[model samples]
Target: MNATDRTPADLLRSALAADPARPLVTFYDDATGERVELSVATFANWVAKTANLLQGDLAAEPGDRLALLLPAHWQSAVWLLACSSVGVVAEVQGDPAAADLVVSGPGTLEAARACRGERVALALRPLGGRFPQAPEGFADYAVEVPSQGDRFAPFAPVDPDAPALAVDGVELTSAQLVARAREDAAALGLAAGSRLLTGRTYGSWEGLSTGLFAPLAAGGSVVLCRHLGQLGEEGLAKRVESERVTNSAV
Candidate 1:
């Protein structure tokens, strides 16, 4: 496994080449009633398409916020990656009223509405699929938008030091995050194929940095959690034992 300093996009592309056929995300979809494993290449393609759409459909401006009220399901992966590629700011755990619109699950639209209070532009959800339910006035993310190819545009250049995520008032930049991860990973003696787990809970700075960038930088794997509820103590013990997690972030 070749390791080096690279953008998250660059790292993902490299990792896909390393194990294109390998499953990057494996989960059971309530809609499908079966397990789904999104391969590295497939996930990367969606990310690229979503990035293009974020650039084309929303025409989202850099430094602007994009609120993701998604479940820790498939689209969440796309949302995070697309935001990084486009240099758009993700205000995690926040409402889209701060943004032009909210891309959310059907269940969360009501909460989004309360947060928005008429200023929010849209509450978008997937049109078809057993995956997530869609309520009225919802713009279907699937059917309503142009084809990925049709919407496909290049990822615009970003100032690496510019704010990529607004977390607790301090903006974290792509460059700074990347640098921190690489430095920390090296210090921790993390290696390729190392199954790294976050020590901190989700939504914390430590959690975001460790779970997201550290693995990408170190050529390792990350196990994302929905909320603390998703991983009970027994599940946690089992996952660590089963996945052979290194727990380098600890």
Candidate 2:
């Protein structure tokens, strides 16, 4: 880890500076037979656009609570980093009633209505496609995000000590999150260039650390699998080989 990295966004920036072309996230949806790979530069571009959408279009300010109701998909990862870039306090699977903004998947749009603030809905389609029709009372994320600027500059500087994430009833500041991620990476025996495969959801601290933060902090990449149980042992083995995964937490 870079000594100067104080937040998740900082870690990502370091990664971008070191190797922009290296694959950072390789996502798979076993149920749909979908696979997508994102290099550091590609991931950062997505984050920038999404951050622009959050800060510019949604008018999100630092410290505002954003309820993130999405599955363990690549887009979910993008939103996580985007929240970090803008200093938005991301609440994973949090109560919508307490959020200043809500971003939900197609499965949770009804539940997200409790948020009296801006609401965005993701169709969770393959290739990040937009919804066939925009859901009522919510902006379509795929549509709105594309028009956002490719480069993001937050209106105010993010504070490393400020609250950044709320997950599984635990709130962690950006600095604490970075420290925990580095610790978790060490505990998992992940080193630079280590490729981790995980089927874990992002609903708990353990899952979040293993699936996203740990590998990222370790200067490694992740093969995030959704509905991994559907893949039999033989298929899983083939995937591990094909993806060159060196570590696993499934």
Candidate 3:
């Protein structure tokens, strides 16, 4: 909302400072009956801790490419903002072998191992839990993130003009990401206090624009669902009624 909010991190900070108690993201897994809601402040805390881990433990610097081989889930959203906060490039569904770091979920272990850099694995369990045992040759995100500092400041300034995201043959600078998100916010009819329900499966652009970026840029909130097919039509209608979703994109 300010002139300086030209990047995802900036917009997040503004949201936190403006109304920390507002629900920013609510996640649900229809197959597992799992629900998690994060206020702006809570989400920011996760981003800060994750950023600290990326900068301090991983020694990742600006322009470092991180292959994000995770499905559309809450943890994936955290990693995306963590990369933006530290000016790292988040390559969702990208080639792991070409990246400086690789983050994989349960099913992508083999592909993640092909990456020649540091590897991190997320169990993608309930409550963002760690794996029962650490995956060989990979750091467990749940094991490492909790001990990281609660606050984060990038060692070097994050450049808004720098490339921040890459996926599906699309690359966007942080500034471009914000600009496009703003346009999408308008087109999607998202404004302050809007509550949007959306499917977790999104294309690269759709994921960034409507799923994460546009809601944040527009001062609204999102209710993201995974395994939506498991929620039958009746179940989905019940959810919409319970969550009071104002807009839906499924």
lDDT of each: 0.60, 0.95, 0.90
Model 1, span 1-250: residue lDDT tens: 3445335565676777788776554333333333344667777777877777677766776776776665555456566667777777766656665675466666677666644321222232222243244355455666533367522345567656777765545567777767777776777667677766554433555666565566666777665544334456896687678757776453
TM-score-sorted candidate list, best first: 2, 3, 1
Better of 1 and 2 by lDDT: 2
lDDT per residue for candidate 2 within 135-161, as digits (tens), equals 999999999998889888889999999
Q: List the pairs of residues colliding in candidate 2.
A: none
Sum up the clashes in candidate 3.
0
Off by over 4 Å in 1: 1-6, 26-36, 71-74, 114-133, 142-147, 150-155, 187-189, 198-201, 227-235, 248-250
Candidate 1, after superposition: displacement of residue 174 in Å?
1.4
Determine the backbone clash count of candidate 2. 0
Candidate 1 Cα RMSD (Å): 4.7
